[model samples]
Target: MLERLQAALDNNDAQGFSRELGNIAKLRSMAQLAKDTGLGRESLYKALSGEGNPSFGTILKVIHALGLKLNVQLPERTV
Candidate 1:
């Protein structure tokens, strides 16, 4: 799952990543996810629906709610 998300990120496919997250969240129950993330259920649905452009904070919250973390890495090339 992480790999798939990473692939979407690497490919610059924001919608794909959001859609995948939405699918996972739905599987875990949107109500539960909303409670866990402290976000409104409808907002979560809109953000992760692959149509809405969610904020970064929202993305982080959803990722954490899904028991995932977004790791940062330096580019391999050195300046």
Candidate 2:
């Protein structure tokens, strides 16, 4: 799952990112995913469909629900 997300990030592709989000099984059914994200079904459709802009908080909840972490990678020279 992480690998798929990483690939999407590497490609900077929204559709790929969204498809990966949609693929999360542990996050529960699509309806549940929508409820957990505090977004309506259509909104969830747009969000994970990669067509709508979602709030950071909402995205955070989705990521958290997926048991994933958002992190920063410091450049080696920054140390």
Candidate 3:
């Protein structure tokens, strides 16, 4: 799931990111996740539905709430 999310971010795929987030949300209730992330349930849903553009802070909150860490990797150079 983390790999999928990372790939989505790397590819700038909004729908893919939302899909991956939805998958993770399925593991826990959206309401619970919202509470954990200190975000409103409706707002969270909207943001993760691939329709709304969520703020970076919101994304960070969600990632941390899900017990996930964000890391940076350099792109491979082609010979």
Best by lDDT: 1
Residue 45 of model 3 has an lDDT of 85
Number of clashes recorded per candidate: 0, 0, 0
| Tens digit of per-residue lDDT, candidate 3, span 1-79 | 8789888989989777876886687577888899998899988888887787888788788877888777888989999
| Ten contiguous residues minimizing lDDT sum, candidate 1 | 1-10
Q: Which rank order by lDDT, best down to worst? A: 1, 3, 2
- The per-residue C-alpha lDDT of model 3 at residue 25 equals 74
Per TM-score, the best of the predicted structures is: 1
How do these models rank on TM-score, best leading?
1, 3, 2
RMSD of each: 1.9, 2.9, 2.0
lDDT of each: 0.89, 0.70, 0.82
Q: Pairs clashing in candidate 3?
A: none
lDDT-wise, the better of 2 and 3 is 3
Better of 1 and 2 by TM-score: 1
| TM-score per model over all chains | 0.86, 0.68, 0.79
Could you tell me the lDDT of residue 70 within candidate 1? 84
